[model samples]
Target: MDELAAFLRTRRARVLPETVGIPTDARRRVSGLRREEVAHLSGVSVDYYVRLEQGRARQPSAQVLDALARALGLDGVEREHLHRLAHRPAHAPRRASAARPRPELLRVLDLVADAPAFLIDHRMTVLAANRLADLLYGRRLQGLNIARHVFLSEEGRALFADWEACTLDTVGHLRLSAGHHPDDPELAALIGELAMRSDRFRRLWVRADVRTRTHGRKTYQHPSVGPLEVHQENFALPDATGTELVVQSAAPGTAAHDNLRLLASLGATPAPSAGGGCPAEGGDRGGALPEEVA
Candidate 1:
């Protein structure tokens, strides 16, 4: 189903006929109030409502949306989602730029040694990651896309304690990204790939949910460190549109915090150097020390 239609159907299903003053009857086969009932409640014609649900209607006016919102008993978030689905242009510009972190941002990331931090774009592509984050996610994060990992990689299922919740949140964020950057071919490609590979992803995508998760608590089952819970916060970068710096922290004095510190230390340690100094001119410096030391 199309986004608008799916959104409307889902919202309608959450409301009961009896609660809306519509007499519920045993003969009613529908799960919730029917399209006709919603039309009557919203003061719109039955045909118009049906057309709107079928994606045949034009962009709904604010008044119409408000009426429908009232009819569906939509909360503030749901109402805003309804408006976005109804008003988004059918076709948007196809040009989408890749999100890149600035050098200054990398410096900032270096300063954040106590927490696991990374930067991600609208597509949840990891633009940059600090040592702690790299250690926490391990080699599985090489794909650099969180959504792809969640749906396509077995590691994702083992990493997150609440896998279903994580997947739902990821999907909702992607839906919001789609709304903001409808013309991004990369974003479209990512969605198409996930839809093809994951039945769960396809089902959630059709729900048309939109959410921006800036702060939340996450539990990870680290292979080496065992279970750890951390509070995650995302900060938007003004210089980079559709890019966010994400940091995960555990409360001070907690065991989780200590575990994270250990993880960071493990990641920060450089590999053993085969050669101590810079090699002779044109000679290979296999595992040589970095330039900062030389």
Candidate 2:
């Protein structure tokens, strides 16, 4: 409930009165819409809304939550987060499931031969990567918590052209994952370690940003291929919860595309067999490689 209150307050602070069709006054001193305004917009009593924000109210009905979501102008991800925080039960924490890319999913990863594609679990652990992805990431990121690598490792920091923007997105990704699996001890530990080690991560974590950015353009400073800008797309694996396939590609005939081709040629090898060892086993020796890569 405390998390719910914080999330609501932060979201409310971001929305301006005029943007929501509430007329603004020059003399208004509030940073955002006042409690009464939010209550009126959400079709609830002012006292009830205050209780919700103060963590004194119990679980709000879905209808009221929906109304509040509208009043606060939340996106799909943010709205879902709001509901989770509000409705989460006060129960014992449960262990998070182990992350493993299914064999079929690994096959899907290998199908994208021209682009770099990899599988990541909710904790940002790199579960698998195709040959091109292996070469693109220089095998440094396999089986590593990507958020930790970005904030704590020199090589990881050097991989991105826009390090700050990339880290901010990483923080938001972790925050979203945390909200979904609050009982996940490994996820909690990862967050705690990063918070202790990286001041940049700490600052971003406090902003209460929640998002699952699906598609965007990103620039990578590949050690072997130089700078390459590519379009990144994230696809959720339907059969597997808390897993996603990320593919990055550049438009044909562009320098980035040429660089990708060069990278492929540089590390071109026989595609791993469908039932071989895990594709990302190069740097990760903590566990036996799954027999899904050659």
Candidate 3:
């Protein structure tokens, strides 16, 4: 199915029948709201909605798009995304080179010395990170790809206390990124690799979940400092459509904060080499660390 169609279907699947006052029926075979139900709710005919899903309909009017958005219960980000997919010109050519984070932005990351800060592109490539973030993530962040590390590396599972939630959120954010840059070859390759190497990633990808990371809390089972909870904040880089600076910190005066300070202290010290060096407790085992929390 086309991108717009697949996205609509997936969003439809997320809404329960009872959510919109639709009576649940035992005879229903499909998950979430059926196409007919959506058609009724959106004030469109079943055939029209079917054609939209089948990629046969004309460019939908803004009114129609808004109606459909409400019917699907899309959040602000998701709603904007739906409009973009519907209105985006087909097969548009893209720049040959992927955009990188600016040096000034890297300087900004440096200024946030006390917190774990890093820059990532839409594809979750760790463009650069502060020393604290480098120490926090270790080898996994070194390879530059966050999703790959989370799904493919054993250390990823050990780092995250809520591994499944982290994986799902990562996949969802990737999906959102894909919608914005549908023609990016590297993004396509990353998705293809994950789908091939990880069964969990494959399942989540097919669901077409989309999420935007702004601010959230995450629990990390830090190998060095034990368990810690940190607040993650993401800032979009100005003039950089696909790159973001992510900063993670714990509340002051909390144990988590003390652990974060300890991490910062460790980061200040020189890292030990693989042979005869002070290895991080349950560190990446020589694998690259994943990107900052999404």
Candidate of highest lDDT: 2
lDDT of 2 by residue, 1-294 (tens): 378888888888888999989888788898888989999998999999999989999899999999999999998988898898888877746744455555677788768989988888888888777778777767644575678768887767888899999998999899898787888898888889889989999988877898787999999998788999999999876752577889999999999999999999984553332212222233432345433321
Candidate 1 lDDT over residue span 54-74, tens digit each: 989978899999999999998
lDDT rank order: 2, 3, 1
Q: What is the TM-score (0 to 1) of candidate 3?
A: 0.87
How do the residues 132-215 of candidate 3 rate in per-residue lDDT, one tens digit apiece? 876676543433577876888776777788899999899989988888888878788889988998999999999887888899
Model 2 C-alpha lDDT versus the unseen true structure: 0.80
Q: Which pairs clash in model 1?
A: none
Go through the candidates in order and give each one's C-alpha lDDT.
0.76, 0.80, 0.78
Please identify model 1 stretches exceeding 4 Å from their true place.
Answer: 95-97, 140-143, 269-294
Candidate 2 at residue 246, lDDT?
Answer: 91
Per-residue lDDT value at 33 in model 1: 79
